[model samples]
Target: MAAVSLVSVSTVKPLGDRVFIKVNAAEEKTAGGLYLPDNAQEKPQVGEVVAVGDGKYKDDGNRVAMDVKVGDKVLYSKYAGTDIKLGTDEYILLSEKDILAVVS
Candidate 1:
């Protein structure tokens, strides 16, 4: 029999240049004060980095350093990454390339 190890969300760690981000909540109201329905809300493209990989390995066996680290608020590409839900929190896992910029 194979051993099954269950991992919790807090212990989740990305691998090989992948980044784990906690997605921000979608806007419930527009800038004009118009309330938007759940289905009408857009997917958020910004999030805070919760975990990151150890960096990708180059052909020369050198590891490429990651530009983003944990706790960084970043903007990612739209429609990119896999969405994950744990308990009441939402998260996304994506490659470092999908991240567009670090929010100041």
Candidate 2:
């Protein structure tokens, strides 16, 4: 498997059922010729999974496997997750339940 490099810190491992997503920037222009202002841009719901946590533990100590993995491109709920920044890059930390679908 290939590796993804996040912050200069070298490694980022999400905790149980959480995922680290590298957010895709919101569009700058509409389908028409109009350009949008900074504050008017929508938050993008699409992102690439850079890291994923181990599956959550079950009541009997069994692990509930995750559906998403690192490198998967996914669509998430528009309002989910905590937004964070590393240097100039923006990212989101979300739970598996917040991910809507994986992009083919």
Candidate maximizing TM-score: 1
TM-score of 1: 0.91
Q: What are the candidates' C-alpha RMSDs? A: 4.6, 5.2
List TM-score per model, in order: 0.91, 0.89
Candidate 2 whole-model C-alpha lDDT, 0 to 1: 0.88
Instruction: Please provide, for model 2 over 8-71, each residue's C-alpha lDDT reduced to its tens digit, 9 standing for 90 to 100.
Output: 4237789999998999988999999799999999999999999899989999999999999888
Worst 10 residues of 2 by lDDT: 1-10
Runs in model 1 deviating more than 4 A are 1-7
lDDT of each: 0.90, 0.88
Q: How far in Å is the alpha carbon of 19 misplaced in model 2?
A: 0.4
